[model samples]
Target: MKIKFRVILSISIIAVTTLMFVSCASDPDSSGLEYMPDMYRSPAIEPYVDYGEVRGRENKDLKLKRSAMIPPSGTIPYYGTDSATVALMMPYARKANVAMKSTHGMYDAVLTKENEYDFALADKNPLKLTSDNMGDLFDTGKKLFTANCAHCHGAKGNGNGPMVVSGAYVGVPDYANLTNLSDGQIFYSIYYGKGMMGAHNSLLDKREIWTLVHYIRKFQDTDYGTSQSAKALEAN
Candidate 1:
């Protein structure tokens, strides 16, 4: 009985030791031989992770499908209950030019054969700058621009951003040189993108884009968005 008990204990120890070895891999990155791998790795779909060849198994259907899908058409996101804000957040009326499908990767966007960028030239910014709000608006614009535009457009809007300096990108036009661009034209370029710049519609809302329009104007004129500038704009 004693010998049998000792043998059972020895077998149990050996089994556990073997399991430890089987579970480990020489490659430090690999977690080998996972027991119930489903429990260890979730089956839930994750955006941007290629699950096409998960765990040495090929899934051709999944391989063909994009993990990150564009939002369905006509889906409006919930923006809170301010009438002005709601109006500001409403879907843009303008459509991308058909050529943008090839030039700007806007294949999924609603496209028109017409020169909509020219049409956008008539679309004035709805976020009217006032002396009371210009301070807050400019502040918000600065933050937004710093996060999204400064990398490529530069902090001073001189087209000498870190990306240009690093030789990663080129042809970022200087705001100082773009005096001919209408406010609406600048907004259109930012919304749909121009040349190498991709569409920012996905990243920024219409209000923010307009705010950026206001901020970018300051790059062209030092007095832009000032109380005096607001009065000057009203006169113009």
Candidate 2:
């Protein structure tokens, strides 16, 4: 009776081991049979995931559909409850020209038949420059410019940035020569892009663009935004 029991126990162990190896052999990529597959793999949907073919089952309806989508028009992202900040963060009033669809690839932007660039000339900088804020504003502007514009616009705003120096780009106008451009025009150009420059609206917020406008002004006039300049502006 003892010998027979030993033989039965050895056969049971061999059978269990063979079954484990056979399960793994079914799929080269998969390990042996999974006890709880969902524990390791999440069922939650993610953006940009192709849901057309899931678990070896193909769904024709979802084949070409993208998970990511553009936001609805006039949708304002939350900017907290600060009235002043919210106002400053509001969407720009000027619409891109229809030509911008072809010229700047702004296909989704609200397009207009009118020349909004000309309209922007009359728009004034909403960010007021005071004697107290000039220093901090310029400091922030310099940092923003360095990170975003310096590569193509130059460290000194002379259109001699590294890209121009390397002979990779041209036609970048110097800020010193653009003294005739109004603050709004400068802001618009930077926001929507001008000539070889691409639109910076995605990279910079409205306030930051306005701040850059102030900093660009300093390039044209060394004493810009200073107490003396403030007095000069007030007198004018």
**lDDT: which candidate is best?**
1
Work out candidate 1's RMSD over C-alphas. 4.4
Q: Cα miss at 79, model 2 (Å)?
A: 0.8
Worst 10 residues of 1 by lDDT: 227-236
lDDT tens digits by residue: candidate 2, 48-88: 87778665568899886896776787889999999988988
* Candidate 2 ranges with C-alpha deviation above 4 Å: 1-42, 48-66, 131-133, 230-236
Error of 2 at 64 (Å): 9.7
Taking every candidate in turn, the Cα RMSD to the unseen true structure, in Å, is 4.4, 4.6
Each prediction's TM-score against the native? 0.70, 0.74
Residue pairs in candidate 2 whose N, alpha carbon or C atoms collide under 3 angstroms: none
Off by over 4 Å in 1: 60-65, 78-86, 99-105, 128-182, 194-208, 231-236
Error of 1 at 187 (Å): 0.7
**Backbone clashes per model, in order?**
0, 0
Tens digit of lDDT per residue, candidate 1, span 78-176? Answer: 899998888988999999999999898887888999998898877878898877888998999999999999999999999999999999999999999
